[model samples]
Target: MATSNRPNAPELDSACVAAYDHAVRQGVFDDSDVAEQLALGEAEVLRIRTVLTDLRLLIRGEDGSATVPASPEIAEAELSAHLEAGIIERREQLARIHRQMRSLAPVYRAHRHLPQASQSVRLVEDPAAVRRELAAATRACTSEAFTVQPGGGRSPEALNEAIARDTTMLKRGVTMRILYQHTVRANLATRTYTRKVTELGAEVRTAEEIYERLIIFDRSLAFVPQERVGGRPPGAAIVTDETIVGHLWRMHDKMWQSASPYDPRDVDYASTSEEIKASILRLMATGLKDDVIARKLGMATRTCRRYMAGIMDELGATSRFQAGVRATSLGMVKPDPNP
Candidate 1:
């Protein structure tokens, strides 16, 4: 137990650190005495001992009853040796997995690129499987990628995850176009993300609303949300059918044409807010409920109701029906043709 040559310990909690320091100074193991010296409960003492034992600083005799504090040097050396052994084992395991996967790479390539009639559509019911499929599609993309994200402000975590993937494709010289609901203009994270990726040669725009989520690569492969039923968990449908992919691409093109290009520095907050209200008014004119309007506009129902209240007040109408009638009269929204 030579302190002079002991290496610095790995970062540990202050309490664990203090206990380790006490162990080094006392050069002995006595739970009662240690607890008294540290003013810690028996459970705390037990926890500290368990943690130190796991760290290899506390060693037990062959009988598994007598415990002793190992010198910091000995503990660090043992821990490093154990970790190096684990790393070697993991690297071997990884190499074995890579070999097995490489052996099947040709089979994967043959079936994946050739779309037989029976294999035109793949319903991936498992979320993890869907992600793997998406990763595969992303890797295979050569010409372009199109994505329509409908939920408005994406979570920061999701945006962070996508930035790397998006930039990688951009680096490969693949064209990328993304569409989102205009509500994203109100989200700081989304705005910042838009600025960053646009600088990297990605086209991003926002429409009043989007019907569904979509991801298409090279106009040959696409992923769409699997229709939900019976409380089933969400999944993705990988579509490689030429006709279906073409139709989806056309729809995306139409939306892209109608969408306004997003520029964080050039955003007009007042104009955007007015456009959202107008869209809400149009949907309201169609007799859509607050929840349905919110869903369509990618907003919360409460937010939708608040906007409705504001619109009604602005129109000097006391009720939703009156508001719609006034909006139509003022040419704010076209009259519902069926009505």
Candidate 2:
């Protein structure tokens, strides 16, 4: 009678095939040793022995030892079975992937229309309205405030309103940082405002070029002017989302890092004199006339001339040419080809 194949025929066939190949190469094997190495029961080993014998792939030696015969047909049959199993597994895997993609089709379609379902943005028209909205947004803030005032000079009413809001917020313990143009250092009203605000614990700084005005509250809301406000109706203001507000706040932080702090009533005459001298040197290097230099530096003509006179006196020069030569020699002005 023919023997029944092992229950795990595929796995047993592959293992027996490998053991046969190795035995053929090595030219020796004990049946008990083979069964132990392959972790097979005696019954499974006996079935493998029968299968190999049927295939005419088993050899019996003179010592009753069992070994494998090198039969190309046996190898070909095992390889074909492995390839068939792999192909079926890959087809099933591809079908599963297609099912998953089909399940996500509705999600993809719903995402395409999400933008239309979002809320519509509202616009604020009047300057007073903008101010009111900004104040309202900031009033609820639990963190710090940042502001940039370009041109440094605002109408008295506008300045008063801003100061009042700042005062209230400061009283409520919100930290504030304000940036202004260097020209404000000379404005009495601006200086007074700075003095008052600094007393309330807000930080102030000055820079040379401030191109636009901005306000950010709690690093979450920001406002920027839409049009130039040079003696015309106030332009529209941009009330920002959190993402844009954070970006503008980062820019403000960069400028604040580079600006000089505003310290009121500290009489640093030498430093003031040095700044005046530096301004004169910069203006002269730019090939500007004294009048243009005066206007650009926010000083009167007489005041500009007085600074030049001081530069001359410091260098002990009697003529403009001598002053320029001495100023360069004393390292007061270095030639800037770009300027």
Best by lDDT: 1
Superposed model 2: Cα runs more than 4 Å off: 1-125, 152-155, 227-229, 267-270, 288-330, 334-339
* Runs of candidate 1 exceeding 4 Å displacement: 1-103, 106-117, 228-233, 335-339
User: Which residue pairs does candidate 2 place in steric collision?
Assistant: none
How many pairs of residues in model 1 come into backbone collision?
A: 0
Model 2 lowest lDDT segment of ten:
113-122
**TM per candidate:** 0.66, 0.50
**Model 2 TM:** 0.50
**Index of the highest-TM-score prediction:** 1
Tens-digit lDDT track of model 1 for 85-192 = 667877888899989998998887567643332477877778778877887778778989999989669889778978878888888999999999989988988888
Q: Give the clashing pairs for model 1.
A: none
